[model samples]
Target: MKKLILALAVLVSLSAAAQRSQDKKKMDAFITNLMKKMTIEEKIGQLNLVTPGGGIATGAVVSSNVEAKIKEGKVGGLFGVHGPEKVRQAQDFAVKQTRMKIPLLFGSDVIHGYKTIFPIPLGLSASWDMALIERSARIAALESTANGLNWNFSPMVDIARDPRWGRVAEGAGEDPYLGSQIARAMVRGYQGDDMTKPTTMMACVKHFILYGAAEAGRDYNTTDMSRIKMFNEYLPPYKAAIDAGVGSVMSSFNDIDAVPATGNKWVLTDLLRGRWGFDGFVVSDYTSVNEMIAHGMGDLQAVSALALKAGLDMDMVGEGFLTTLPKSLKEGKVTEKEIDQSCRRILEAKYKLGLFDDPYRYIDTSRPAKEILTADTRKAAREIAARSFVLLKNNNQVLPLKKSGTIALVGPLANNKNNMLGTWAVSGDPQTSIPLLEGMKNVAGNGVNIIYAKGANITNDTLLAKKVNVFGTRIDIDKRSPEEMLKEAVEAARKADVVVAAVGEASEMSGESSSRSDITLPESQKKLVRALVQTGKPVVLVMMSGRPLALEEENELTTAMLQTWHAGSEAGNAIADVLFGDYNPSGKLTATFPRNVGQVPIYYSQRTTGRPATSEEFKKFQSNYLDVPNSPLFPFGYGLSYTTFSYGDVKLNKNSMKPNEAITATVTLTNTGKYDGEEVVQLYIRDVVCSITRPVKELKGFQKVFLKAGESKEVSFKITAEDLKFYNSELNYVAEPGDFKVFIGTSSQEVKEADFKLQ
Candidate 1:
């Protein structure tokens, strides 16, 4: 029977391989024949992707007459525009009016979800449940594909340690290993097994090569880091996305080393394609190809040619190739062969999407009512949002609030539905979101009284508020003064048995170009929170932001603190679920929440410093800060549940093992506190010695397990030499025989360590 099963497996594998070969041949033949009939202008047009009016314009559209361009065969794709009626109109123009009838690809920043919004990517990563993460992407793909989108600029995958980079909210946090896992899951979820399926869209793993490591945690800033650092930490997630069969890549706006990522052949071609073998097309970030001039690379034509040589296949919103590539080709800077190669890649992607067969495959206007923001999708969003929320503190059992009591729901965000869907909810409707006031009322019975007050404005910083309002009026000044608002909140808290302060950033504060230097609760909200606390009530602070905020003071002040992280569409309902003990939060912090902004880039996987401080004790000569301790307000993988979990000492199968052999690390986790809960049992590994210095620790594996009260489960992880592999001085990935340490923990900082050796 085993032999028969093996034969069947081999047969299935061969059949799939044969199908892939045939599909590739068919795509090549189709593109080759199409290119043969195409003129130079037409070919360059196929490489140009533009944003039409009435879409989420990230940058100024270089060409506003996108419909005319499509008619002229000068536009290959349209993004920023969603909805079937508009997309079909654009598709109809490309098919009926264009010279070649090339169907334009419709792309969008479908980062989390389309219509039915889910949590931000960072918040999704906090769940640490790969299946759940993948399902979120799957649901996102289903809804997006139904709404005329064939591509997604998602699964940002860039490993971010600096929370100050506003785009940090878009990526997996800090650790390369965990980021890689999430990257693969997102890829699988977005692309699924077939690109041609109507439920899936092409996944574009974005910001290629370390955009997350922007200097001083600023957006689009120059990122200068050692190659060793790149391969070990930053590059892994992109590579993982590639390995998982991501269909496209979006080049970042930042420079890698000295060269901008959109025009770096060494990074894009030599490494991404040649080394990693990513066959998918590469799209430039909005106007990134033309922005090469800002990088001082060359003239418009020169940069266009340079980006082409650097393996950029599509010029998104720049029209660089359409306007300048032909000029560059005539000047003998870029060859026709290079242009053909890129055009073919784009054509092949469309073919894989089955767009060539039916240009209007995604243009079903009827799917919106049937598929978009359905009850099922909203339920999924609510469930996922609940899992995405991280419980930072639950001192005095302040959470799991009794549903029968008088609860004061206070803050700018308490009743505001506008900011509930978080930052990148391009297609999400704010009206669909349930506000905290409504959610609490719904969750509590008639026996409960839910009082509410807009305790403060989203923020009081004039300059900051002005900037945040660029996208929309998310924050409006209250008619009542801050003092009056606080008085109302205090009175509400005084009347209630418990207080829930719904406060944090508005939706626009932590997305693209929204970096924050001081990542703490706004002073107005802080004052409000302090006032509520002074009312002598047990207060639960609910933070709603896209990135991790420093909550050292709040952690000390509040009876409980929850990181809601701008959870999308169903934010209020999900928060209410946790508050009312309907769901136990199992989400963990994927990024380090520093005690203060001074510890900006602090992560769990930093190298052992030459003069490492032994403890928080101030060692004057050591690598230590004078005023602040080198500890995070809340460490990565740190989250609390209504019930407490106790992890037993890590047990290893062997003290020593051969490089080929695997070591099994096991830990028994018990739900020591009352109530059923879930715990993410994390497995972290450390290389004590290596070819070069290694990080203090790296997250290797994790398991999310559910345990009822008094129930214990043994979580085990298999660690092979592959888990120990790292890029050495020569940039060769290898595992060195050395002493290693394995940590089994609930969080990175609090762990039980066990040492082992590799032979």
Candidate 2:
């Protein structure tokens, strides 16, 4: 029996290997045959990515004379074009008019969700439900593919600590472990183990290296960090995506070690292709190759050659590759073999997408009717949105608003649908969105009286409002003055039994090119909220924004506060669910909320300084702030729940464990409050002493569980030496034997400590 089993296993392995060899041979033969018929211009054209003029213009690089270029065999791929009809029109031009007859690849920036928008990526991370986050990506793929897009620039897994960076809205928040988990889930949801499926679009893991750790929380700024920091902190999520079989990668706009990522050979070649074994092609961020000229790399032509040698295969929305690669080859600056290699990668992606099988595979005009924004998709969005809403404060249990009350919904966001879908939901329809006023009415039914007022514009500053409107119509200035709007808002609050103040950024206030030095609430909203609080009615603030807004003042005056991050198409319904107790909020803060902008880069995982800021007796010369506290307004992983939970002392199975052995830590948690709720029980580890200084605490494991009011459940986590591993100064990932501290609790800030040792 053993001999027969071994024989069968060997046969199966051989068969799999043979099948892979056959597939590779077939792919190589096809690409070789096609390249033989192509001229240098046609091959170079295959590497160019151009955006069609005027379809969903998110970026500034809409290609000029796009139709003429496609016909001339000067264009490779097209993005910013939507609808099956438009995509088909461009594909037909390429296949019928170009000499090579190569089908054009259609791409879109379908981040977060498509037409059936879900919460922004940061908001989604708060849920900490991997399955739910993956489902959001799945739905996005379904909608985007139905609309004729074969490639999606999505799953931006940049691990950002600086909330002031507007692009944080596009990523999973800090903590590489959590970001890596979310990254894997998103890749699985998108690529789905098969890129050939019509519902599964190819996933592109973006911003190649550390685009998240920008200097001073500035967008597109240079990022400089030690090799150990990259391996241990910011680079894990991108590696996770690659491990999950992500199909493509996008280069970041920022430079690392003073070398632009788009033109950095060490980043694109040695590390990504050599160490990580990433086989996917790298596409430059929008015009990044050309932008390298401004980085003092060289002229446009020189930078283009540098990018090609650096291993960037696609020039996203830049004609740099199209016009310069051929010139560089003629001048002997670049070789034809390099051009052919990149062209082959482009062709390979198309083949895997089944575009070669049928040029119109994703362009079925009928699919949109059945697949886009269906009832089930909207339902999923609502559930996920509700799960994403972090209950920041529920003081006095002011939330779970009673259905019988005459409620006043005040603020510019109260009745606005334009801002509901948030940023980068390019295909989302504002008309289809249900506003908060409608949501309250839908949740409360006919018995409740709901009054609403446009308390203030998203921001009353004229220049700021105009700048924000560059993205969308987020601000609608009333003919009435700010004072008049405040008067009406106060009057509405006075008459109501309770006030639900809808406040925060417009959709454009926290996306790309929208960084804010001062992340505090707009002064106009602050005034309106203070007036409402003076009304003596319990005010519930529904704060909607992408990044965490500093709400120190609102946190004090408001009886309850909810952080609803631009909850997508079903924004109103989901917020209504949490407000009416239909859904118990379990979302935790993935990013820290600073007390002020001065603490912009604050996060939980900081190395222990010589003078640590503890709550012991104050030391004047310690690392303490003179004006504000060193602590954030709310720490990372902090969130409130309607129900209270009691945690028992952490119990460890052993006092020590060998390098290869494991230790089990257990905590007994009871729902001590009145209602049943979900809790995200967190586990943090601290290396007491190490060769290098470690963080004060680092989140290692977490479990999301549900418990009835009085039910107690013991949650156990098995920790091994592998969990203690970190990249040393020598750039080697190692686990040093040492004493360790284990903490288990609801959040990073609140935990029960236990001591253990690594033998």
Can you list the residue pairs that collide in candidate 2?
none
Query: Going through the candidates in order, what is the number of backbone clashes in each?
Result: 0, 0
> lDDT tens digits, residues 392-492, model 2?
88877888998886889999898999999988887788889978888888888878889889988777788988898885678878788999999999899
Per residue, candidate 1 scores C-alpha lDDT tens digits across 382-497 of 99999998998888887798878698989999999889987877878888898788887877768898998898998887788889988678888877789999899999999999
Instruction: Give each model's whole-structure lDDT.
Output: 0.89, 0.90
RMSD to native, candidate 2: 2.5
| Prediction 1 global C-alpha lDDT | 0.89
Deviation in Å, model 2, residue 288 alpha carbon: 0.9
Query: For model 1, what is the alpha-carbon lDDT of residue 705?
Result: 95
| Position 652, candidate 1: lDDT | 95
